[model samples]
Target: MTTATPYDAMFSGVIGQDYEMLKLLAPLAVEMSRLVGATVSQHPKTDDKPLSVVELGGGTGITTLSILAATDAIQLLSVDNEPVMQGQAQKKLQAWQAQGKLAFCLDDALSALQQLANGSVDVVASAYTLHNFTNGYRQQVISEIFRVLKPAGQFVNGDRYALDDIDQHTRTTQTEVGRYFRILTAANKLDLLEHWMVHLFSDESENHIMRESLALQQLAAAGFAGIHLSNRSEVNALVTAYKPR
Candidate 1:
């Protein structure tokens, strides 16, 4: 009889190149996930009803695991368009789904948010996913997040937020790229190095990267109050905002 490989052990191999490149952001992701867990715990359940949470992109259940660990009374809807990534998440998080604490929507963030009823969910959360989108689409998703949230509901995100200073941003990106080249070269992962470098470029591009200052501005404009950067490590930031009651 063969023993099953633990989900945690299998996760890295399942995610492939993404695991190698994105492992750099793991520390920041942990902080972000913990913040989301803490913030949601602050909002008490209403009329014994479970707290409704809509997670924007459930990449292999990393963030989802954190949220579920926070409370058993949460109903989590994890939305992601990528089937492979979502499948991995589903497998890892099967227990939560079986317990009726989790469900998934295989759809893009904006479309999934659009389908949610206005003032329906208690929280909207994401990790390391939003910055990959073009500014226009991201704004649309933010507006939808505002719409779907119940009054006083929260939005928590942990993601790469480019620095507002162009000079500093450029210097930071250069240093990061240099480090990536050194590490990947040592690992003889030049193929992954090239892929990560291009992805990094796309992330830093004008139409894609959301500067830290700009994200706060967008959140405020969307009518979310208590907008603030809760945590930051290099370019990764955890931003929290709320719809006023």
Candidate 2:
């Protein structure tokens, strides 16, 4: 049986090459530091204590490392379904963990969220993973997220762009689409590039492409307030919101 390749350089081909992803990622880190005052945990502490953080769908650990490098956060929990990706992440964060900095849990998103006690975390983060499921599953995942966050706790999602709605005909323009293509060209991985572009362009999976606005709205309806645009690049955006205290 053929399982999904966990180490997909194609993701960087799609999301990373977007000038917006690069630009917004830097500022988002600074903003996260300013907004969430949690420090990297030095000693073992219960979730009831202060400044706990859990990250869902962290693949290969690049973003996780970026967050740790940018902030003084503890109780770092990263979850993903792909073992190859998780292994890469574990290797990357091994040194920090040697000094007591990070940890990982391999599980599906909802189960991972459920494992955490309610109202325990200061911030919950997920990147680029929101756009992979159907609307119902997405809503269910968001509801679980709503349930886990501490009152006043923050959730920041470095996710997809708000594409054009069905009725109105507006989306990232051809030029922007070309930009995504250019990244693939530059990356020089033709086989992977062709596979992804074919799937993405052909609409092989409609439910997988989560509309950014609808996601924000759903999060809002789930009782998360203070929603705001945390990052934007061309068509992709990473939004943030909070569960009230």
Which prediction has the highest lDDT against the true structure? Answer: 1
Residue range 122-176, candidate 1, lDDT tens digits = 9998888899889999999999999999998889888888988889888877878
Off by over 4 Å in 2: 1-50, 165-173, 183-188, 198-205
Deviation of model 2 at 198, angstroms: 4.4
Candidate 1, which segments miss by more than 4 Å at Cα? 1-21, 24-26
**C-alpha TM-scores of all predictions:** 0.88, 0.74
Clashing residue pairs for model 1 = none
Best by TM-score: 1
The weakest ten consecutive residues by lDDT in model 2 span 34-43
The local lDDT score (0 to 100) that residue 38 gets in candidate 1 is: 74
Candidate 2 clashes between residue pairs 3 or more apart in a chain or in different chains: 20-233, 39-72, 39-73, 40-72, 40-73, 40-74, 41-74, 152-244, 152-245
The sequence of per-residue lDDT tens digits that candidate 2 reaches over residues 1-245 is 02565443334433323323333323443343323222222222435443567777777675677667655545578888767667777877997667666778888888898787877676787766666666777888888888888787777776554565543313443544465466656867455455555545422256655666767788889999988874465445667788887
> 122 in model 1: Cα distance from truth in Å?
0.3
